[model samples]
Target: MRIISKIKTPGALKSSTSNLLGRFRHDDDGAMSYVAVTGALIMMVFGGIGIDMIHAELKRNKVQNTLDRAVLAAANMDNTMDPEFVVQEYFRAMNMSDALSGVSVDQSLNYKRVTADGNATMPSNFMSLLGVDTLQASGSATAEHGLTKIEISLVLDVSGSMGGNKIVQLRDAAKGFVDLMLPADGSDMVSISVIPYNATVNLGDTVSQYFTLDDVHDYSSCATFETNDFTSTAVDPSTELGRLGHFDPYNSSTSGGEIAKPWCATGQTSAVIAHSSDADVLKAHIDTLNAGGNTAIDLGMKWGAALLDPAARPAVQALSVAGFVAPEHSSRPAAYADSETLKFVVVMTDGQNTTQYDLKPEFKFGMSEVWVDTRGTNTLNDDRFAFRVQDNAGDDSDVYYWLGNSGQGYAMKYQNRPESSAISNGVEPYQMTNAELYSRFSIAAVASEFYYPAYVDGFLTYDDYANAYYGYQATVNGSQADTNLSTVCDSARDNGVVVYAIGVEAPQAGLDAMQDCASSVAHYFDVSGDDLNDTFSSIARSLQMLRLTQ
Candidate 1:
């Protein structure tokens, strides 16, 4: 498209031609079109890069979170979860399988460490056109365990109901737990106190000195915990709170036999085994646990928490000095504020609460019943008296009057009788009725009237009349004991003690009570068919996790 024809002067023609050529070569008319296309391309590239960057960031965050969780799970002290599999599983669960890689675990005698690293390639958009196919994102995490000092009180229910296979299962499970918590070389910082409780807690003879020592049943190895013990979470043996007594079943046979069984039937005054790091010792003590006596869970729980309380430190020290408790654990009952120290109480029970009986301090040394009879004569009736006594005195007399009718009453009408040394005289008979004299004197005076009846009616002691005098108080049963057990459990929980309650073949009420006593709903277990081994193992695993987290 050229219409060519130009004529000008020689000088003007050269300048014009040069100007035309320069304009044709440097013209900006089409430059705007090319710039617009280039600008659009640049915008696309930047937008694609921004999008890819955001995608990479999101993928990296997801990978990091997943890896962290996987490592923690793999690092669980008691779990056998594989590190690589756990990491890959988590990634798959999150639908980020491409990011899973480099998973590893390092386990030691007392520690576990898990590490995981993962990478993902984020797809690029317009950047791919420039040879940028994808952006790589990576994440890594490591979880490790620290040495945690744990003090556990295994409060087992050695009640009559936990007999036979249940006890065996408990032993095996408990020994397994001990193995889990205690190091094989016995060099770890874990201590366990095995407390087998029933109607009462056996503190033994030496341990008795640590307590206030209720001398009523001083000869026994067990102690009946009072309501105050339940009210107070810590059982400070240094305080004059609880009393030492024989484990006397509420309604046990009193058929003129040997002394009542130790309240908890702890074989031959088996004193409580204080805190120990020796797993064998703990297992041995657990094996010695026998099932007998009524259920006094409160006592068991109270002592369990007590041994973990700092208030019992002095007692622990004393016991350690006396070689009763191990020297290393003498400083036990570490302060509650110790963050690195963990305290646990595994309370196992098989029955509901039962009646608990305790003996009074003083011997039951009085006559139970006294009666006066009027005999012979008309004007003045001669009064003869009868007396029955059951002596629980220290004179080696535990026998009650086993005579025909001498086993009936707790106390006689009079308390102090006239001295047997006093001369017996056939004096005068008062005009008072027989019942009148019977109602007026102390048990002792009634004894005098019976042995020296001449003073009242010029009559002799009757050889025929006899009656029984039951000395002990009536047995407490049902709701009373249940309330006691519940009260103690509440106290234990209130004191910030972590209680893991296990109910084995127990009544509904017992299961409910155990569930309520637990630190949380998840902390309770009910094994009706006697699968206590699994329950204990689960608890041990949970405890191991806790230790790892610490």
Candidate 2:
């Protein structure tokens, strides 16, 4: 229809065209409508362009505000800042009432990924007639804080239970931890300690300088059993407590129970792997460790104290023939001091203290009656609390706490007595019986009498079993355990050491141990088997950060 109209108007258009051409050729002053209409069209187009540009500038300002705020927030995370809180506050700061208050922020780790959704509402001028009332704009930005150096101790449990798929899991977890601590490319970052503790930790060959091994310790001289004297001089070897727990039918041992075998490495040793160096070597070592022997947590922990210990480095050099300590620049204290170095012991065990040695015992069997005394095991240290009452099933009623004083559980078993310290005149019993129980005795007298009972057990001496096989002397409270732990922790703290505790499939006893050792409850990790990796990584990161950074 438009084409037919143009064709029909051709004759009329020729007359109009001639007039328009004559005016343009002369640049005529009289004809002004054409110029006015053309100018109006140009202005209309430019008005829309101006509106678009203004919208773009506003969007750009919003993006800049988000980027600036997010970057500053990321930087503040290094001061032990909470990332979540920082993200929330930063975005809030970027959003303002007069400006973009509806800005949204997405946070992760230490950085904020921000997006600016420009206003969906705008006051349109010339463009509004095109059926557009508002224009939308958007942009994105990222910010992050600088991380510092870290020192971490990766104390792992390489005990018997960690066999099977567990070890494989450990390898993967350990590698992950290392990867996390390492700087992305080049940064003087973190250091790690891989301590694998079983019955005894193997500090490897570095031990001779710091330890005296079992060969030097006579197994027979370790400690002795009960008071009764047997008619035959030779007792069954089966009843003997091993130097290390007698090897289980599963453990490598001629006898079933090897008393206390060495748990810590013979020297100032710890886990072997790539430490502060390459990853594959350390991971390989972790993979290679076999879960073996009894769990000598105390010994393993003490050795853990040594490997990261600066004091032991000097001693390692003294035993050069073994070639355990390399005489290199890295071994120097200064070399170590500059880098963030962490010492950690992640000990996990499903057992309790089994091996207690260094005492003696003497027992005599009299016709159907067993009379027991100490030939070994106890040594007299006035400071060491000796259990005044013996609490075997037959004797619990006769013991001290059964009568009273349950909270003061850590009784010093006189450490120096050659014979049973319990019955010795120098050793007194804890008279638990109160004065109320004693008609003639005053409260003071009764308290003194039972709290320090004169009638001691002859077997309670320097030479007795630390404890009998499955003979659990009830710990009235966590007193004894706490004292032992407190002594170690305070000493370490005095020396500026940070002690961490891990409860890995641990019993209440183990939990107490970790609590006793940890600087605070937050530093302790109570975990089931699967959570071990998470716990390990958390510890590794903490230790790494503690050492590597300010």
Best candidate per TM-score, number? 1
- Per-residue lDDT over 113-220 for candidate 2, one digit per residue giving the tens place of the 0 to 100 score: 333322324465656666766565443444433223333445566676667766666667677766655534533433445667664444453233233333323211
lDDT of 1 by residue, 363-390 (tens): 1222224433333333222333334233
| Candidate 2 local lDDT, residue 148 | 36
Best by lDDT: 1
Distance (Å) between predicted and true CA of 417, model 1?
A: 14
lDDT of each: 0.64, 0.43
TM-score of each: 0.63, 0.42
Clashes of each: 24, 98
- Global lDDT of model 1: 0.64
The per-residue C-alpha lDDT of model 2 at residue 490 equals 49
**Residue 322 Cα positional deviation in candidate 2, in Å, after optimal superposition:** 11
Q: How much is the lDDT of residue 365 in candidate 1? A: 24
After superposing candidate 2 on the true structure, give the runs of residues whose Cα lies further than 4 Å from its correct spot.
1-73, 76-149, 163-168, 183-188, 206-276, 315-347, 356-486, 543-550
